[model samples]
Every structure is written in structure tokens, then in C-alpha cells.
Target: MSKAHELLKKYWGYDSFRYPQEEIIASVLDGKDTLALLPTGGGKSLCFQIPALVNEGICLVISPLVALMKDQVDNLMKRDIKAIALTGGIHADEVITLLDNCVYGNYKFLYVSPERLQQDWVLEKIKNLPLNLIAIDEAHCISQWGHDFRPSYTKINLLKPLFPNVPMIALTASATLDVKKDIIKQLEMQQPKLFQISFARENIGYFVYETEDKGYKIEQILKKNPEPSIIYVRNRKMCHDLSFQLSQLGFQTTFYHGGLPKREKEKNMHLWMSEKAQVIVATNAFGMGIDKPNVRTVIHVQLPENLENYYQESGRAGRNGEKSFAVLLHHPSDTVSAQSQFIHSLPDKEFLKTVYNKLCNYFQIAYGEGIDEQFSFNLNHFCSQYQFPVIKTYNSLTFLDRQGIITFSQEYSEKIVLQFLLESKEVIRYISLNPQDEEVILAVLRNYSGIYDMPTAINLSLISRKSNQPEAVIEATLLRLKEKGIIEYTAKNNDSSITFNEVREDERTINRVSKYLEAQNELKQNKLQAVLDYVTDKAHCKNSLILNYFGERGTADCGNCSYCISKKVTKSNSEKDSNVLLKLIKEKPLSSRELQQITKISEEQLIFALQELLDNDFIKVLPNNKYTIN
Candidate 1:
């Protein structure tokens, strides 16, 4: 067997690669730049991972989300693979050490954010590493037309010049034709090969329902389906509110959003994954690295701003190819609300300038000062002090960051560090004195090394699990140990960070990207219009509409979609009842009840046929609640 196949079997226990995976891997192994457009749950990671194992040097993976990086790294470690992720909020010394490990320690994979590439030290260190391949996950972000555009992704071209001979692979689950072309152009790939698996997911049944009472409708759907489900909402508050409502409706449910602490988020996610919770109410932040295969339904309470976002989120269902549902509940006011909230509320150039000036002032950086300085930012406090809307303020900050004025990273989790202060004999003596703290302390010591010399990052949850103790007890014991001066413990903090990229600039300099920003705004508006069009359209097949929007054409109508099924039922009823109505009307004008009695049709069916016939001018309704031929 080939080395790639052997590694796949030994590590992932897979006997064969999925469709297009082996081909993409072969292309990369031949030292060719490649782009793989796999759908969600199509096993995109294995394409890069298997090749990295087969090759001799380390593979550099550029990812966008810190959570996704951490998840992949953890999974790789569990499989006994040496992988490290350099995410935001890590200490600079740790980063240097990680880079050194990649160069000398024979690490197989190094995952870093695109923003990290902007650092001179990082670039210099990467240039020295024995790099074999450069893999870009979520590659669509490199393009301005993508739903999640990050300006930092454009800086990735710098790596091409640094490692000219190394092959590169870019992967994304969702991208339009325009975004696909732009990704290749921006990355400057050398005659890259393109591999795309069809975006159509045949197993998922698409559905849309127009209703006023969403809560009741949701309950009805859940009761009828009664399977593991995801309910996606727009905001954090709605996550909690909908979760509470579901629980009240007799559902074992949990909620997740980006604002929650890392530990809480993990706990809720574990509950859902383990099937302890029947439903999860979440925002878009919930499902990046989640690999649950039996997700029976995905319900969208509000319309997403674009089809890419919608497709990616809804695609989470039916990974096992079992029958599943991707349902959208649309209220009459949903479109207007979505447009006002997502488009009109975007930060204008003047507003962005005001935010930039305020941020500089808040950080106490004089104009033309404070370049490359990092600070722990409290966005809530800043917004409260300045009386700025939190969402709009966040959008403005993101704009400034994308314009290359600053680097704003909101998703950062604090790292916990622990150091043993007591000598070995002294530690034994203290442990004897405090028997209650013995289990956790011993677990920490057994799991981690070099704690006597310097603080090491510790996973308290892991310690709790191994020690067979509750997390709260383990935390209290650590605090007691700290009080006794036996060890030093630093609890994790979840906060955001900001780094000034360029020296403080005036309004004119801040507005440099105004034209580009306007273009982005227009794109967002157009995308929003597309979403509205999908929800309001009732004539076409839902699957066909979605496929066409993604640049696929001539897709057959999915016979099982809500629209198709409704059309079939309507046609059946009209054909059966219209014949009777036409025959009765031809004999004589008659009352509705008389026609129903003569045709032996139910009242509802008779009325429906009469309406259909009247619509076609084959019959007409008279003044006294009677029917006649037109």
C-alpha cells in the first residue's frame, strides 16, 4: 500500500478515500497547487492531513476561526499526530517556541490564522521551517465577494514568495464562481487544479413555511419530527429565549453563542453531541467544527443575509445521508427586518472614522503614535462609555481592521497557567497536611511536566475527568493550594484583543477604503435581495433555486421538497374535484352544498375546485353564494 493509504488506515482507520479526495491528494503530492471545493461534511481535512503524513516535512494550515483550529489540533493529538495551532492570545514566547518546534521537533502540521502571517517574526520563522505544503481552509474568505471576507487573508500571498517551490491547497465548503476565481487570483496559485464536488445534497429535504406564530409552528414541527435538531437564531438574546421556550415545551435543550465562556460553550456542545439534549438553539457561531452525523433537522428562525451562509448552515443536516430537513420559517416582516438590521445599519465612512478616533483616544495613543501595540480591549465598556450601539460599533471596528488600520480579534480565550512553588519534599509534606487537594494536585503533576520550573497551560476539565472529581471541587482545591503558597494558579479570562497595525492616522487616511467599503455594502445588499427572493418565491423548486444561485444549472426538481409536494397534492386535488364541479356546473347553476352533495365531495374539496374553476373562467360564483358556468 502507498504511504498515504497506510497513514490513513493507521490514524483515521479509513480503508479508502471519498470521491475526489484521492485525486486531490494525488495532485498535491505531485507538487501542484490545488483547490478542493468540498461540501460540508465531505471530509476536506483528510485531503491535507493524509498528504502531510505521507510527505517528509511539516504542513502549514491557515484557518480563520480559533475554535476550529483548537478543535482540529485536539482531534489530531488524540490520533497521536503532532500538530500545533498558533491562535490569537498566545504569549509571544510561546509562539516562538511553537515555531521552533515546527522547525526542529518534527511536527507534522502547523495551523495559524492569516492575521498571524502579518508579524515579521512569524514570517521569518516560517521561511526557515522545512515546509512541504500550504493549506488554506475556508479559502473563500480570500475573496471580497465571499460572505465572510477577511482583509488579512489577502496577506497570504506573501507566503508564496517565501516558499516558492512548496505546493499549496485551498479548501472551502461554500463559494460562488466569482469568489472561486478570485481565490486563485489572490493566492497567485501556479496553474492550480480545481476539484469541485457537486454542491447539491440530495438527502436533505428543503422546506419553507410562511407563518405568523413562529413559536407554535416550531413546537409543532419539533413534535412531529422528534429528532436531534439545531435551531438557528440571529442574536445572542434569541438563543437564550428560544432555548427557554423549547425547554418549556418539554424539550431537553441547550443554548450556545459566541458570547458564552469557552467552558460553558463546551459543556452545552457536549450535551447536544452526547444526545443528552434533544435540541440546540444557537447562532452562526455554533457549527464550524461540529461533526455530528445524525442531525435530523436544521431550523432557521430568521433569514440569513446570503445564500452562502444559508447553504453552509443548512448543510449541517444529514451527514449520514439519512433523510433530514432544512427548514426555514418566514414571517411577513422577516425580510424588512433582515434588510434594516443587516444592510441599512452598516457603519458608514463617517461613522467608521469616529470609531477610529475614539479607539485611538480610548487607548491613549497620540496621533501618529501607537504602531504595532497590542491591548486587551473591553468592547462593552467602551460602547457604554461612548454611548455607541454595540453592533454598529463592532461593525465599524471590523471595517477599520479590514482597511488595514488595526487588527481586531474578538474571540480569544484565556490560557490557564500553573506552577508548583514547593520543593518535592515540601510538596509531599503539604499534600500530607491537605489530603483533600491531593487528587487534583497529583493529577496535574502526572499530566504535565516542567511545572516546577515554569507555569504550564493546564486543562482543568481534563484533570477533573481523570481525577473523577467535579470541576468546581478541583477549582476550589487549586485556589486553596494557591492560598497556601504551594502553587501559583492563573485562571483563564475570556476577553478580546486589539493591535494597532499602522500608526494612528487622520480621518482622510482612515477613509482610504471608503470606495471599497461602498462596494462591499452594495454586494451585501444584493445578497440580501437574493435571500429575500428565495423566501418569497413559491413557483420554483426550493432545491433548484438554491442550486441555481450557486452557479449550478439544469438541476432537476427535487420531488420531495415542500414546494414540489405541495404542487403534487394541489394538482391531485384539483384534477379529481374539478371534473365533478365542471360536470355539475354544466347541468345547471347550483348552490355550494347542492354541488357537494351531488358530487359526493367534501365541502373543502368542493370549494377548492370551485375556486380553481373560477380562476380558469370555467365557472363563476354568483351573488347568493351559488355557482354557475362562466
Candidate 2:
């Protein structure tokens, strides 16, 4: 066996590499730059991982998401491999120590974000390490034509000259031909070998249903499937509300989203991952870098923004090669909802400029200044201050972040800090004077320590629960106490933070990337249209349509999706049942009930057969509304 296969068996315990994985590993081991387009759950990681293991030096892996990077690092460490992820919020001294470990401690893998590469100290340290390979996860983000483009990713090629001879590998779950070409160019690869496994998930059956009531449909699907399933919604409110609704209906359920706190998110994910929760209702944020092989059903409560997201989300099901389903439930209102959510909320160039200007002004950053300045940003308050629509303004900030104009962190958090001005006995005396504040003060004193020494962060929700008071009332009491100088209190109700990456040059900054802005808007429109077409068109095979969209040709139906199933039913009934019904109808004119009594077939099949005959002019409805052979 080759070293790659031997290392894979030793660490992963897999008897052999999956198809094309071995081939991709061979190409990478040959010191070739490679781009691999494997679908989600296709073991894309092992292709780079095994090669890195076979090599002598540490592999540098660059990714965009902190969560994904952490997950991979954790997995590698579990296998007794030394790996480190240099994510955000790390101190300079700590980063230096981590880099030192990579150089001297014989670490095998180092994961860092694209933005981290922009730092001079990091790049300088990287040039000193003996690099083996450069692995770019979620490599599609490097392409402007890709769905999740990040301008920071485009600068990753800066590492190429530093390690002139090290081979590179770019990996993504889904990418179109345009994205593929763009990736090669952006990475400056020299005649990179391309390995694209088929994007078709044959084990997954795609289904779309149009219904007036989505909740009922969801319940029905869950009841029928009764397995580990995921129900995806569009927003955090829907994620939480639907999970609660399902729990009330007697489902073991949990929820996940980006806005959730770190501890709570991990807790909920643990419950679901341990099979304690049979159903997990989540937004699109739930599934990246997560693998659950036995997911039997994945139901979308609303239309996805695009097919790429749909394919990736649905591909999470049936990874173990058992029969599974990926269902999409659509209502008439969903069209309007999707339009509003995706299209109308898209920020134009003018709107982008307005948001950037307002953001600089909000932080009191003068023009020609504000580079590298960070601040706690409350998105709701900022929008309310300027009377801007919340969604559009948020989208504008996101666009700015993607364009590398700023770094926007949308993880929601609430912070409350408290410090007592007086000693412990003096706090007791003050509480005695203000009896109404006794419960709140006592709860704070009982649950927290060192409040008299310095400002310590406290959980407002926990304090409310402990004091048996509402959060609003607790906030008011704290403000009253602060007003009277009893204690020092600071409350920060912020959903996000922003760091300006460039000096304030409002219009000039906006104009610099206007082409990207226009192209991305047009791309969103096209992608949205493709999703709508996928759900609405019932004549073609859904599997084939997906394959064709990804530049596959000469595809065949899987004989399992919703469209293919319906076609099978129609063919079966039209050939066998239609002739049987015609023979009975020819003997005598009969109403539909009379026909059912004679044929004893299902009403659905009977209706389909009758419609087929009527369309062919072989039958007609008499004046009495009875069926007759024409």
C-alpha cells in the first residue's frame, strides 16, 4: 500500500479510500496543484489530509469560517494529530507562541483564515516554517463568480511566492464551471489537475410540495419519516418558533443559528448530535462542517435563496447510503417572501455608500481616518437612528464585509457589567433604605463575586431568573441605582461589531468595487431564478436538472425523486388502469362513483386514468355528468 493509504487506514480505520479519493491523493502527492470538486459529504477533507500526513512538513490550511476551522482542528487532534487553528480574537503574543509550536513542535496541520494572512507578522512567521502543502477549504469563496465570495480570499495567492515550491490544493463541495475557472486563476495555479466527482446524490430523493399550510405538511412528513431529520427555515425567529411548536406537538427538538450564544449553541448541537433530539429546526447556519450520516429526512420550510445552498443543505442527508429524502415545502406566499428576503433587500451601490458613510459617522470617524478602528455595533439601533430599513442596511454591511471594506461580526451578544461603589455593609444599608431594590441587589450579590472590586460582566437573563423579575424591570432598577450612585453599571445590547479595514473614503471606496457589486447582484438574481425554476418545473427530472445545472451532461433520472415518482405512477395507471376503465365504461354509461364501485381501484389512479382518456378524445362527459366512450 502507498503511504497515503497506510496513514488513512491507521488513523481513519478505513479499509480503503473511496473512489477518486485515492486518485486525488496521488495527484497531490506528485507535487501538483489540484482543484477537487467533490459534493458535500464526499470526504473532501481526506484528499488533502492524507497527502499532508504522508509529507514531512506541516500543511497550511486556510478557511473562512472560525467554526469550521475549529471543528477540523478538533477532529485532527482526536486522531492524535497535532493541529492548531489561529482564529480571530487571539493576542499577538499567543499567535507568536502558536506559530513557534508549528515550527519547532512538529505540528502537522495549521488552519488560519484568509484575513489572518493579511497580517505582516503572520506572513513573516509563515515564511520561516517548512511548508508541505497549502489546502484551501471552501475554495469557491476565492472566485467572484462563486456564491460566497470573500475579497480576503482573493489575496491568498500572496503565500505562493513565500513557499515557491510547495504544492496547493483547492477544495469545495459545490462549484459551477465559472467558479472552477475562477479558482484556478485566482490561485495562480500552473496547469492544476482537476478532479470533479459527480455532483449527483443518488441516494437522496428530492421532493417538492405546494401546500396552503406549511406547518401541517411539516408535521405529516416528520410523523411519516420518524427518523433523525432536519427542518430548515429562513430566519432565527422561525427556527426557534418552529422548534418550539414541534416540541409542543411531542417531538424531541432543538434549534441552532449564528446569533445563538457560544455555550447555548454548543449545548443545543450536542443534544441533537447525541440523538436526544429527533428533529433539529435550524436556519442555513446549522450544517457547515457537521456530518451526521443517518439523517433520513431534510425538509425546507421555505424556498432557499439559490440551488447551490439547497444542494449543499439537502446533501447532508443519506451520507450513509441508505434511502433518504430532501423535501421542500412551498406555499404561494413563499414566492413573495423569497422575493422580499433576497431581491428587494439587496443593497445597490448608492445604498452601500450611504451605509458606509453613516457607519463612519455613527462611530464619529472623520473622513481620511477610521482605518483599523473597531466598535460594538448595534444593527437595530443604527438602522433606527437613520430610519433605514433594517434588512437592507444589514445587507449593505454584509456586502461591505465581503468586499474587504470592513470586518463585520454578526454574532449576537448582550453584556452587562456591574461594580459596587460602596463596601458590602454600605450596600446592605442602601438596600434597606431602598426596599424595592432589595430583591435585585440581593440576587446580584448572591450570584456574583468581586462586584465591589471592579466591573464584572453578568448575565442579565440569569439575574432576571434569580430575582424573579422581568429583564426590562431589572434594567430599569439598575439604571435607577446607577443614577443614585449606588453602583457603577454598564449595559451593552449589541448584536454585532464592525472593524473598518480602510481609511474613510466613502464614495471612492464604493466606486472601487462597483463592478463586483453589480455582478454579485446579477448573480443573486440568476441563482434565485434557478431555485424558483427547480421548485416550479414539474415536467423534468429533478435530479437531471440539478446535474445539468452543474455542467453535467447526458444525465439520466434516478427513478426516485418526486418528478420521477409521479411519472412512474402516471405511466403505470395510464397503461393498465385506463384500458380496464375503458372496457367497463364502453359496456354502459357510468358516473364516477359507479365506476369506482366496479373497478375497485383508488380514486387518485382512477382520476388520472380518466383524465388521460379524456385528453385523448376516447371518453366524454354526458349531459347528466356521466362518463361515456366518445
Residue 438 CA displacement from its true place in model 1, Å: 15
Clash pairs of candidate 1? Answer: none
Q: Which candidate comes out best when scored by lDDT? A: 2
**What lDDT tens digits, residue by residue, belong to model 1 across residues 1-630?**
288888889998989988999999999999999999999888999999998888899999999775688678777876768788875545577678779878777689999988789788889999999999999999998999987787789999999998999999999998989999999999999999999988889999998876555787688778878888999999889999999998998999999987787668879999999999989999988887787999999999999989888998999999988999999998657888998788877988888878888999999999888876778788999999999998789888877766556767666455578999989899989889878888888889887889999999886545643454655577778888899898999966757778776678777666666776777788889999999999888789999999998889999999877777666556687787898778877888887657756877753355456657877998876666467888
- Lowest-sum lDDT 10-residue window in model 1: 460-469
lDDT of 1 at 434: 78
In candidate 2, the residue pairs with backbone N, CA or C atoms under 3 Å apart (3 or more residues apart, or in different chains) clash, namely: none
Candidate 2's residue-wise lDDT over 11-115, tens digit each?
999889887899899998999999999888889999889999998999999988756776687677657787887755454676787899888777899998887
Query: Which 10-residue window of candidate 2 scores lowest in summed lDDT?
Result: 461-470
Quote each prediction's TM-score: 0.81, 0.77
RMSD to truth, every model: 7.4, 9.7
